[model samples]
Target: MVAKGFTVDLNKPLVFQVGHLGEDYEEWVHQPIVSKEGPRFFESDFWEFLTRTVWWAIPVIWLPVVVWFISMSVKMGHTVPDIVFHSGLRHICVTLMEYSYIVSFSYQTKSYWGNTMHYLLHGCHHKHPMDGLRLVFPPAATAVLLVPFWNLIKLLATPSTAPALFGGGLLGYVMYDCTHYYLHHGQPKKEVAKSLKKYHLNHHFRIQNMGFGITSSFWDRVFGTLPPQGKDVKAR
Candidate 1:
């Protein structure tokens, strides 16, 4: 369980009530709150609990879904290479899709267009970097997203490919969530873990716009958003 911390009133939109100092709202939101659990979001006890997620829940709930979808393709006679290629492709595509919702606005408009949505999505994580529950995507939200994606895959691909493709997507999501949690909380002895933690943390603390890649920096390098080398990067 995430360590107990201050709770916010869920009845009101969150960003407006807290941390929106008279100064710029954009700047305040990115100033990491640095607590295991940041202020709570819901007024009701049940919803407040549901919003925070445990890191292990990502694999526990989703791995079975991945297996089920991949199994469908296997039953349809899809070969190992076919599944592997499609799975990796699905992973890459999922990462790319994240680029859509990530935008920075100089003007804070949380009251109407920008407020509650940003807090529920990206801004909350930036503000509450240490909130373990909010670190990974909630399974409930993922399930809702999966329905359309599953149908879209069916619409686009043959029976042989669609299941594996969707399965790969589920796998990628699990990996992404797990990796994100580790990047925040795990101790890294290996070079790869050390590197990924640094890359992701830098995104949170130092350079907000760059280093968008979480599990790997390949995307950042390809897109030219990778944090520059040879500069002093201090952890706050």
Candidate 2:
């Protein structure tokens, strides 16, 4: 069955079938299992996955690294003002790197899997934004990328600077997760949220290439991908 504006090809063999009911009767039946599973409890799914895997060790993994950076900064005896300024600039750089990676992925490939990965990473929310259990990244998948990111920052910046920047970047991810979850599940009907919900829905229902930003539409506006106001954008 088609929901929202997406088309469902039930005519495909995978979705069409024949069934027998009894020794005396036989009939054709069509039933499809979309995806693999149904909704799960948000907290139960999150904590259960987090506690069971080595990937769950991510929060602990960075602690020592963060502590070492703070120690190095203190040992350097830099003035508070100098420390603050450098830290702020480094954070901006980290944020830029995080943003750049997602945008670059969009430009680098035309494969459907590449597009699906993007959706799995971020677009899934737009598709089923209110699916509460899927709001957060699975810890196992998220940890795979964290190490490479940390190492990249280490090579480009001083030990002291890298942690501060990484900290800010991590904070950005947290904000992204929280805001995205709220955008989908929160009940606020205020103008801003209403507008945001509509903007996000358009991305899912109409133009997938446009309106890529979630926490803020700054990137969409900057990249000239923002959807037109007040008009229904049709999907490709």
- RMSD to truth, every model: 5.3, 10.3
Best by TM-score: 1
* TM-score result, candidate 1: 0.85
User: Which residue pairs in candidate 2 collide?
Assistant: none
Across 86-160, the per-residue lDDT of candidate 1 in tens digits comes to: 999998887766543343432365343455566667778988888888898888888999999999999999988
TM-score, every prediction: 0.85, 0.57
Lowest lDDT sum, 10 consecutive residues, model 2, at 19-28
Candidate 1 Cα RMSD after full superposition onto the native fold (Å): 5.3
User: Which candidate has the top score in lDDT?
Assistant: 1
Residue-level lDDT of model 2, residues 1-236, one tens digit each, is: 33233333434321111111111111101121223122222235554444232222434554455545555666667555655666567555544554454455344222345443444454334334445566566656666777897798799887766666665556556555555556555665676776666665565556655776666677677778777776752211
Residue 220 lDDT, candidate 1, scale 0-100: 73
